[model samples]
Each structure stands twice: as C-alpha cells, then as structure tokens.
Target: MEIIGFIAATLTTAAFLPQVYKTWKTKDVSALSLPMLLMFFVGVFIWLIYGYYKNSPSMIVANAITLCSAFLLIYFKIKYAKTP
Candidate 1:
C-alpha cells in the first residue's frame, strides 16, 4: 500500500511541475489570484506540518511537493503582476 500511495503522490505532485515551469518562464499570471495562491500555500504548509507530526511519509511528500508547487504559483502571481 505504501507503493501505491507513493505512486499516487508522485504522479499528482509531478503533474504540476510542467505547468509551474512554463508559467514561471512565461511570466503570465494574469489568470491567477493572489488570494487563492496565498490560501493554498498556507493550507499546504499546515498539511506539511501535520504530516510531519503524524509521521506519515506519504502525507509529508505530497504536502511538501504541493507546497513548493503552490509557492511557485504565488511567486509567479507577484512577479508577473508588473509585466505589461
């Protein structure tokens, strides 16, 4: 079951990478909401902490990756807002 959980986490976590890299490179954040990004980042952070406290590797990996991906989205939102 750990393998299945890892695969699921890996796929979902990886699924966001290409989009994040593309958006970061293009600096097109016009469609993103800062509040939404902030909320997600905070939520993911809490989940990461909870995962750590619970000693669940699956939760830890998934939440950590998600936090980073979400951070990228938030970063793009701020960094791209000034772009014309």
Candidate 2:
C-alpha cells in the first residue's frame, strides 16, 4: 500500500513538471487561468498540512513539490500577464 502511495504520489507530482517547464521556458501564461492556479496552490497547501498531520510521507512529498509548481505557475501567470 505504501508503495502504491509512493507511486501515485510520484506520478501525480511529476504531472506538473511539464507545465512548469513549458511556462518557464516560454514565459507564456496567456492560457493559464489565474483563479485556477490560485485555487490549486491553496488546495495543495492544505493537502500538505493534512499530510503532515497524517504522517504520510508520500502525500507530504508530492504535495510539497506540486505546491511549488503551482506557485511558480501563479507567479508566471502574473508576471507574464499582458498589459491592457
């Protein structure tokens, strides 16, 4: 079960890397929604807290990495937002 948890965590956490990489390299956040990113960041942060309380190493590690990626996306979205 723990192995399954780690596997799930690794896959889910890794899923965010491509988006992060693309946003970093392209500096284009026009397609990313600010509200969605903000919501995701908050949800991941809450998951991290829950993980800590639950003593789930897999959840902690996954949420931590995902939280960073989500935060980066949010930053990119703001930084690269077009001026109107």
Candidate 3:
C-alpha cells in the first residue's frame, strides 16, 4: 500500500515535467496563460501547507515538487512573456 501510494504520488507529481521541458526547450509560454499558472502555483502552495499541517511526507514531497514545477512555468511566463 505504501509503495503504491509512493508510486502514484511520484508519477502524478512528475507529470509536470513534460510541460516544463517544453517550455524550457522552446522558450514558448505563449499558450500558457499567466493567470492559469498563478492559480496553479497558489493551489500547489495550499497543498504544501495542507501536507505540512497533516505531517504527510509523501504529500509534502509531491506538492513541493509540483510547486517548483509550477513556479518554473510562472518564471518562464514572466521571463519570455512578450517574446511569442
């Protein structure tokens, strides 16, 4: 059960990578809306806070990675926003 939970968390959380990679490789955040990214970052932050409050290591780790990935999108949105 624990292994399954870890696997689920890892896979789902790692799902943010492809989008990040695309943004990194293409430097294209045009299709990525700023408000949407902001909302996602906020949601991830809330999930991290919830995980901390609940003392769930898996949740914390997963949310932390998610937050970082979302933040990367936000960063790219801000950095290369006007380009394309």
Itemize residue pairs with steric clashes in candidate 3.
none
Model 1, 63-83: lDDT tens digits are: 888988998898778877974
What is the Cα-based lDDT of residue 53 in candidate 3? 96
lDDT, candidate 2, 1-84, per-residue tens: 678879999899888899999999999898999999898899999999999999899999999899899989998999989986
Clashes of 2: 0
lDDT of 2: 0.92
The C-alpha lDDT values of all candidates are 0.86, 0.92, 0.87
Off by over 4 Å in 3: none
Which should have the higher TM-score, number 1 or number 3?
3
Candidate 2 stretches with Cα past 4 Å from truth are none
**Residue 27, model 2, lDDT:** 97
Model 3 TM-score is: 0.89
Model 3's alpha-carbon lDDT is 0.87
- TM-score of candidate 1 on Cα atoms, chains taken together: 0.85
Stronger candidate by lDDT (1 vs 2): 2
- What are the runs in model 1 whose C-alpha is more than 4 Å off? none
User: Which residue pairs collide in model 1, if any?
Assistant: none
Query: In candidate 3, what are the lDDT values of residues 11-38, reduced to their tens digit?
Result: 9987889999999999988899999989
Could you say which candidate leads in TM-score? 2
